[model samples]
Each structure stands twice: as structure tokens, then as C-alpha cells.
Target: MNQLDIDKMVLRLNVGYNGFKFKESDLKDGELKDWAKKNNLLKSDDKQKD
Candidate 1:
């Protein structure tokens, strides 16, 4: 997906789980990427054995 799609998806999913009160300043691009990795929503490092 493009950046816009990713942004929308992140915002919707974040707020849905968090609540409308989550300050946008609390997010970073890396956090989104991290979430995708940790939960397997995207992918994890191939060399990661943890």
C-alpha cells in the first residue's frame, strides 16, 4: 500500500484500539513499523531468533 493508505490504516486501527484521545504526537513512523513486525501484521526480521 501507499503511504496514505498506511497512514489511514494506522490511524483507524490505533484509535480504535486506543480511543479517540490518543495524541498524534505519541506516534512515530517506526512505531507503526514495529507494531507490524511484533504482531506479525507485516513481517519480522528473517535472522531474528527471539
Candidate 2:
């Protein structure tokens, strides 16, 4: 079996966070909505910054 790095995957999903830094916790979400909230993606109307 192969296990993907969910953290890297989640970080890459964020258009603002693409190629940007992210906290390991971002990958801990069981749902995208929850993850988005934790990473401030829901409230972030603009591109994110490092």
C-alpha cells in the first residue's frame, strides 16, 4: 500500500498556499470545510501570504 502525504496535498490545494508554507495541522482535517476553517481559507477572500 502507498500512503500519500496529506499535509503536502492539502497545502497544494490552496491556491494561495501553493508553493507556500503550511502548518502540519492543516492536513489533520477530516473534511475540507473544517480544514478551510482551520487554515483561515474560509475567511480569506484574497490570496494568502507566507
User: Highest lDDT, which number?
Assistant: 1
Best by TM-score: 1
Q: What lDDT tens digits, residue by residue, belong to model 1 across residues 1-50?
A: 88856865776675567544333234455766555445444322344443
TM-score of each: 0.38, 0.29
Model 2: ten consecutive residues of lowest lDDT:
1-10
RMSD of 2: 7.9
C-alpha displacement of 41 in model 2, angstroms?
A: 0.4
CA shift of 42, model 1, Å: 26
Candidate 1 residue runs with Cα over 4 Å from true position: 21-50
